[model samples]
Target: MKKKAIVLLGNKGKKYEYTRHNFGWLVGDLLSEKMDLFFRNEYTYSFAEKRIDEGFIYIVKPMTFMNLSGQPLKLFVKHKKIELENILVICDDVDLDFGRMKMRPFGGTGGHNGLASIVREVGTNQFPRLRLGIGRGKYGMVDHVLGTFSKPEKELLPSLLSKATDAIRDFFILDWQELMLKYNTKVSV
Candidate 1:
């Protein structure tokens, strides 16, 4: 069987930690824990790999900052010889409501810089993605994505993170379409 990889993009500095933009990192961290994997610096990012029943799963936290995430990602993909369909990107979505997740097979960046970088480097927006909603309101779209979550938002974060992690695991067992139908929702699990 072939190995499957998932690349997660997020900022590198401490200032970006816990911010809404780091939601992808948050999910990656949680998933790493659940899978008993630890990240190491490699290919311009912090990455971890684990062998699951189906194949190897890789979690990447890009060190190239948000806007230039695709460079490292493309390198990793080519070096590992993994196909685009085997890659699932997790990112924060401003357009989605808080706690909601959208599983897309392929689409535009939807105004996400990290995603935009990926599309640019890969020359297409045809890979699958799992988008986590951080909510948009008083903080405005820009501030909301770059800002830290509120106390209430933090309270609901763990559950949502767990669900997103599960959704990714489900991707290993089911195709993106099936996983989206079962797990995509506004409610927190």
Candidate 2:
């Protein structure tokens, strides 16, 4: 079976924990814990792996800061010998409303620094990606992304993250087209 990679675009350090910029990491961390996949610090990521059928799923959290997310990702993919097509990058998107998500087979970076870095490092924007919504309001982009979830959002984040986790699992069990048809929308879980 082909080895697949699920790269959760995020940064390290407790200071960034639970921030909107690192929410993708929360989903990866939660899903890994729930699936009993323990992560170990290796190379430039907090890496976890699990075997499903004849294939393997590698869940990774890049240790580098957000804008430079791809540097570590490029290294990790090369080390694993996984092709760009066989990977999905899960990241936060400020264009959609909070809790919403969208998936694309490939496209331009949409002004996202982390994605821009990934596109540059991987030498292509033709990789699959799942972007979680983190919409901007009256606040500036930096404030919106660096800010914490609201009171209601704090309560909602766990389930949302869990649903996102399920989405990752579905990436393996179901076809990519099916997964996108079902999950690529602004609807709540």
Candidate 3:
């Protein structure tokens, strides 16, 4: 059976639970609940795995800080022997509007430190990624990415995450082209 991984990027700890940068962790929580999967703490990450048809899908959250996310991923991929193409990274994108997402087969980091680390550690930009929009707010870039969501954005978060998880589940079942065609859009929520 094939093995695939969904690498969710976010900082660990309760303090960051509701922050914009922790969006990937929030989505992972929702996806875990929907799939009835529980994460197990590893040395450098937390992960949950489930069998789907003839394959296994591993949902991973790197325990390292957001900027060092790729460190855990590099180790995990080496240990699991999972190919780069079979790993899908999910992360927040400050440039996009809230409720929007872009799914790409390969791309540059777009100034996201987490993605930059991944490209550096993994030695390539040729990996699938799902960029969730967190809309740059009035604050500076660092503050905005690390800040909490506004009232209205918090209200719409659930719907956006639901669509994101839907796309994640599809990643294991559908081809990359098909998943991109179906999920790359600005949701009007």
Q: Pick the candidate with the highest lDDT.
A: 3
* Model 1 residue pairs with clashes: none
Span of 10 residues, lowest total lDDT, candidate 1: 180-189
Q: lDDT (CA) for every model shown?
A: 0.86, 0.85, 0.91
RMSD of 2: 1.3
**Ranked candidates (TM-score, high to low):** 3, 1, 2
Top candidate, metric TM-score: 3
Report clashes for each candidate as comma-separated counts: 0, 0, 0
Estimate, for each residue in 1-189, the C-alpha lDDT of model 3 and write its tens digit: 789999999998888889999999999999999989999988899999999788888999999999998899999989888999999999999889889998998999999999999999999999999999998888698898888898999999989999999888788778878987888878756
Kindly report which residue stretches of model 1 are placed more than 4 angstroms away from their true locations once superposed: none
lDDT of 2 by residue, 1-189 (tens): 778998998768888887898878888888888889999998777889998888888998888898998998899989989988888899988887887887777888889888999999989999988899878856788887888787877888877888788788787677778888878876575
